[model samples]
Target: MSKKNRKFLATTVTAAAVAAVLAPSVSADELKFTDVSDTYADAVNFLVGNGITKGVEDTKFGTHQNITRVDAAVLVARALGFDENGKYKDAGFTDVPDRAKWAVNALVQNNVVDGLSTTKFGSYDNLTRGQTAKLLANAAKLPVNDGVTKTKFTDVNENFAKYVDALVREGVTKGKEETKFGANDAVKRGELALFLDRAKEHFGFFDLFVMHTNDTHAKADMGPKRATAVKELRSEHKNNLLVDAGDVFSGTLYFNEFQGAADLQMMNYMGYDAMTFGNHEFDLGSSEEGHKALASFVKNAKFPMLSANLDFSKDELFIGLQNNRYTSDYSNGIYDGIVVDVNGEEVGIFGLTTEETPTISSTGEVQFANYVEKAKEAVAAFEARGVDKIIALTHLGYNDSLNFDNDLELAKKVEGIDIIVGGHTHSELKDPVVSNEFDAPTIIVQAGTQSKYLGTLNAVFNEDGVVTSFGGELVKVGDFEADAKAEEILAPYKKKVDELMNQSTGVSTEVALDGGRDSNNEGNSSVRHNETNLGNLITDGMLATAKTINDKTTIAMQNGGGIRASIDEGDITVGEVMTVLPFGNALAIMELKGSEIKAALEHSVSADLRDDKTGLKESGAFLHVSGLKFEYDSSKPAGERVTKVEVSEGDKFVALDDAKTYFVATNTFTAAGGDGYDMFGKAYADGRVSEPGNVDYQMFIDYLNVLDKVAPAVEGRIVDVNPAAAKTVAE
Candidate 1:
């Protein structure tokens, strides 16, 4: 009844085959229709498989048998869900040769059939094409144009003209030939099966099958598993789409060496229908080439990448390859959105990225518009195209902060979106979540990170273009075997990666670097809660790197979660440093007030828990400092935890002044509020941050080269007054 729901429900009818495709498939082998050829067998299988008809015999379907008027009534009744329970007078039934008496009665009771005379039901005569049209039109309750005396069909008389016009208007048939109806000709059994099937789609039922993934951050090794799953699932659904939400770049050595080429190959081979650009997709936008790698990835992708709110026109690398509006005719290019026709259903798809892209990633000149405004415009454009079922492939986090642009807020603000396949936060939505934000429901789904799972969603939409029934699940990639063809394609890339990981970085350590999770012989994760020598060494490297670009940058920090693995006391390989900082996070230098620094350090251990079994539980937010020393009282409350904070002035440590402003360096992830560092994000948004575009591992490697032999120690920079959660003085 609402304007949004009515835009897509008007003026269109699909063939009855839409019904068969939506329901479970029935093999042609199950039916004994030997006379039906492979080309025409689908319709016959649909009829017999759905209990709408039985063959003339057990081994044969009598494919070409003449369908009498009474037989037409029987088939139409079954297709309309009318059981033969109606009792009738001599008006239209009870005299049609017991085989079709009840069938004729049901049709007559429904006002879909009429007798030639009071005592006659036209039982023995072969049904005419014109009569078939009238029966189908009446049975399916199609709107008849009573004044339509003239139609495309020249042979149709005034009596059958309205009924034939109704069928044509609903897209039931084009006539026997395009211009001729052959109104008086006898209908064959096969022909009737096709007609009835075509008429069934007018009942206003639609089904959509979706296969989606998100936050697959360069986990290229799982390409084979994904390929196998995508291929199998694509074949299983008739009306389907294969889509990804975003974040397909960064995270592993595959991206480090290949620069999204390897991931693009796998995506193209696996057949992605559409994709959206995640923020990390533009990670190299600040490099010398300025988005050259991202441009190549876009140029080579076999599928269209949708981006409704982002603009790349200013960048020469994306010239002629990107468009600014929504379209129905989509190919391999970037557009605001695209219209996909799935089994005669018009599904409008668009993409939305977080507005925080500029502050977060190395987006360079590529501008990001407000997500909510663009999303509304996209839905309006889709509505103008008469497409009701809309899908938004998004990189906006699923449940990010309400103040930020997230999928929940988008769904709540937008009026007509039916499905939202999202990413960015990397949430593994085991089940679909619905937002009843408007008159219609919007179903949101996200596949977990690293290509570990594939999301499958099956939904049933009503004539109003609203989802009435839905189900979704995450399929574990590890459960399936690797596809052979994909493995063959991946072999060369894997070899190159193995060789790169094994290549030495020309730097060695005297003792173990102690990047391990546990610092003491206790359960506390050393890298996260208690500082280690490796943390100190890594931060020292960041500070050294940042100062080379901006001498004002005096302090450097690293999030505990960013340090993944430790190194042994030996020659460090390129792979060893890469393993430690696998995210490919770039260096970000931010100018912050000393008070803001204290707030950030406090939030670092705000959630630290001391469990009886795990000893002290620290979150990934714990910070490893480089040019400063901070002390916290773990026994005190969170906001009041930090006891004292000071900055190192060459050889002397001076107490940090509350009003002083200082420059600090950290990874791009943390500078953008990653791991709950909102203070850094606030500063970055205020334009106090500068990204030198130096990759984190490359900086570490550079620092390692300068040091030659690493021997760094945690010299009481971060201390805890409460001895219970503190590491021993020697440690």
Candidate 2:
């Protein structure tokens, strides 16, 4: 057999043997045996839960009882998947009773133990330390020390010295005392339990449960549900870690009003271990009030905020915030990475935020570095500190191409990361994506956006920290019971949110203004794909608001992603409007050449949808426009997709003049290069754009107030010209 296979067999057999003897057969509630040490309670409970051993009587474990040869044989047999009914050739042993026949036969058949004289099995004899070591070493299939002549143990017989050495080499034992094996001493039940637990750990048979969430987006109401999950999971698994992969800010009226305070309270109450920063975390750092909101979030958070690549030293707002220069303490509030001990095992965890933060959000003076490089450095640092199990908590999207680092790329490039909890693309990964790019396995998982799902990834690793087995699933938070304490914490916040939600804007809609993208005109609606009345209403509001600043403002646009939710057919409230535009972006008016406008349009639909057999669909960058009409052919290349573009000239539509400049209105996020709008960002940087000092949602609210009974309809402002054709768009 190959060396790798041999090693695997050795560890597997050792784990099996240890697990069989020490695995728990009942719950802690049913464990009446009370002699276990407080420090080894979990270990002893594991033994009982796995059904490896049972109490000597109905309510007594006989912790001081001496183990016999037959007792050891029975445990080893059961661990190796053999039972009393398992068929095996009978070993002719005179002394082994019929009750011990199966165990003796199993041991003899498996070549783990033999009879004293090929005919007499000493089944009732008390098992000695050296004899037990020999049996365990043989059962584990450890390599024989054929060349060793010296004995490390003072009292171990020469015949059993090799077995004791093998046991020590495997970390299964270190002898009863420093230099003595106590070769002739009887093995006690407690000593046996300790040995089995150590062997199980040495072979990496222990459980590690990781509970994580991403893109929560200030759904503080779901805090109780998340807390319920964490509490239940922690009870079931002794080794558990709770972490968030960022985007804890924005998305609802709660965030708009409380500005992450409510979320921070809930997170602390739920006992979050660590969290990474998402782009939304920096969304409010540009203005003084916004900066204070972020500062408050950091100050109130009980857990560490991790960002290895971000340089916050230059940012004055973050003064005195603990930076993870060399420490791993979570109380510091800011850290690059941390080494946490879980059930006596060291777990190294680090964070990575997308480098696209500066262009996508208001990061102020904080700068970002390459995610891959930072990840490599973190891994090296952790490894230097003797940490093997590494987890990368990231806000990088699962898969995106805005020059932003993504989870899949990070997993493939960085070798040591065993798990990647990610967010930012709002992807709902039902199952973990396991990538074996290096020698070890890297698991990438993301829960769906908006606290809708909580992801749990349970993994089993070998001694070398390589993932040997793993399984994961997203748990629907709606199915879980909410914690009462969390609900009590959110009661005041909810009361304030309700007041905002109750205020009617008087713009009653007759239909569910479709913001959802239903590309084929099917019932499946999605704002990211097809045009809708809601998109029209939002863009028209921007255009009208911009016109108040500059009469020359002729067109307005908004990325579908910025539109968070759809308004139901009823009286709209300020809360609903806030939820729809929760990013708090201001209106930006810019002067761009007609050619640049067309280029922006081309960039909007540049996402490739042909691979999914859905032509020109489901791109968040899909533009919602007002005061302009355009048609694109999906079969054409990206830059050349826009075949016809027209601008409103009085009551007539005129073809766009390629060289003429026109004033356009959009959200500051889009105008400053959010959603890959490079041309718009450049124009703003070059003094070609001006801020109108109008909050995006306030502009919509104002427009709603102007038109008391608002009704918006799709008027063919944007059209898909090769609508029936299934073709690819050039990258």
Best by TM-score: 1
lDDT by residue for model 1 (1-731), tens: 23443322110112231222112212343334578886556556556634578778866777788998988788887767565665654343445877777778777877988888777787888999999889889888999988899788899999999999988887667787878999999999888887875665554546688999987878899999999998888887777899989888876778888999999999999988999998788777777887998899889999999999988988888899998888877688899999998888899999988776676568887888889999989999988888888999999876554445788778888888889999976667887776654656677899877788999987656666776546678999888899999999999999998998899988898878876776453554478787889899989999998887678787999998899888899899988898888777767788899999999999887865575422236678989999998998877777898999999787988999879989999987898788989998788556576654466887888798988468887788888777765444435
Candidate 1 shows a clash count of 2
lDDT of 2 by residue, 507-577 (tens): 77776766554543363456776678999999999999888767889999989998888888877888788
TM-score for each model: 0.64, 0.58
Q: After superposing candidate 2, which stretches have Cα over 4 Å from the reference?
A: 1-202, 326-328, 504-535, 539-572, 575-731
In model 1, which regions exceed 4 Å deviation? 1-203, 401-404, 506-511, 517-529, 539-565, 578-623, 626-628, 632-709, 720-731
Q: What TM-score should be assigned to candidate 2?
A: 0.58
Quote the lDDT for 548 in model 1: 75
